[model samples]
Target: MTSRRSFIKATTLASAGLLIRPSALLPVSSRYIGLQLYTVRDAMQQNAAGTLQRVAGLGYNAVEGATYTGTQQFYGMNAKAFAALLKQQGLVMPSSHYRLGAEKMKGADVKGTMLHGWDKAVDDAATVGIQYMVCAFLSPQERGNPDHYKQLAADFNKAGETCKKAGIQFCYHNHDFEFQQQNGQYPYDILLHDTDAGLVKMEMDIYWVTRAGMDPVKLMNEHRGRFPLWHVKDMDSTPERKFTEVGSGTINFKNIFKHAQEAGLKYFFVEEDKCPGDPFASIAKSIGYIKKNLV
Candidate 1:
């Protein structure tokens, strides 16, 4: 575990060069501490109910999901049943991750993904009490010319409409790839510029932003209210920059979290894409540190 003194030191140092306004120093506005279920993918695959119980036991009141099965089920349960299961554990899933389905699919053979059966996906999300539905990742084959992102922006706007009708916010989650320059333009910037802010919000992954050598606070300041959900994952200090427990890493979450209001952050989830050991134990350490500090 990273000690309180070390955490504060990291925060101060990271905040040193930036101009910190009084408002920026205020604590994060929302108190709904959340976890991304993908962090415990193996455990979830084995036993979702038990995994969620452990998550709630670790003091997480909320969760963000990453898996939506081909059968349109969540962890092997139907939308309503999954929602009920979450309620049983006193957990509310405010956000979930979905993908862009096959670019070309046979009639009525599509799964509930952004590109194919979005309406159904949104409907199921609503059933699960999910307020945010995020396009989780872009597969390698999906990546093409810069025009693709523009088309994606259009698709996102369309998807956002469906989600809006269902009272769900549609967002896109980012990885470091989005930040890389493509034909002298960052795809991420294109997404931000082309999309309707009200329609297509963002689920900013802090670790990836930092991994790409970008400042999360700066992005927030540049595009206010564009981000409503955040993946509060962390990067280690070493050159390899592996995923680590929240406070145990080099990322200065304290400073970044203080600017939550600027980011339009409503709910933030702690996520470690790959953990060093027992995933539950990793999250337990993360939540403990967050409760004592970040949240």
Candidate 2:
């Protein structure tokens, strides 16, 4: 059915590596799968390079870093070196986790944290091909005070400005604790309402939101486009309500994924803080189900 002119155009596009396949034309969230390296933390600690190879072999197109150490190295490699390794495996690092320096060691000079050397961290993130730099967690000492949350919102806005200047979006990653009431208002709400939506976006951890008894779809509908990053994991059906592989759990991911466009999702990383048996096998199951059904 191809005309000669159309055929030539197609040939030229393909030759120039610009040919858009059906899958390529599909929504990015539907086609791409990324892993949060924390899922295989042990393996990564043991052998970062080999673990990345095995992960790429499992068909992940991207990855998110968990441990940006006090030394400002990802895993054990500097930003440029780590980025090179990811490129070698045909993988991209779209996002990486950073901290607010709430847990810094005693008398230690830590660089590349939210509270210290943040600009340097943002610069390093840019070098590593990261589009998003996330405030990964809040230590217990940092929570329980409404004043602290308000201060955090202010701090996040400042950090967001720094990231914006560097061409990166700053995001906050949540756990269930954010949903808990603080002075009759949720800290998460404070963070969401106080920050500039353009600068400080949210990285919604679907599992945590669900665990907090909130609907991910509803939240996305409420704050459309504010959430661009997601942590994709599942909850077991058991009473314990623990982490399980993607399709093996009770989350309606097929339905959630249908709303990806509304969520403004650019990238999602599969993360399981705790996995029984081999973590690689667990990720394999998660990505397999995602490719087959969810995405």
Top candidate, metric TM-score? 2
Which window of ten consecutive residues has the lowest lDDT sum in model 1?
A: 11-20
Per-residue lDDT tens digits of candidate 1, residues 95-180? Answer: 89988875444545448888766766776776677778898988886776799999989988998887777666899999999999
Candidate 1: list runs displaced more than 4 Å: 1-30, 103-110
**How many angstroms is residue 152 displaced in model 2 relative to the true structure, after the best TM-score fit?**
0.2
Count of backbone collisions in candidate 1: 0
Best-fitting candidate, measured by lDDT?
2
Q: In angstroms, give how far residue 290 of model 2 lies from its true place.
A: 0.4
Q: How much is the lDDT of residue 46 in candidate 1?
A: 95
Query: Model 2: C-alpha RMSD to truth?
Result: 8.0
Candidate 2 clashing pairs? none
Task: TM-score for candidate 1, please give it.
Answer: 0.88
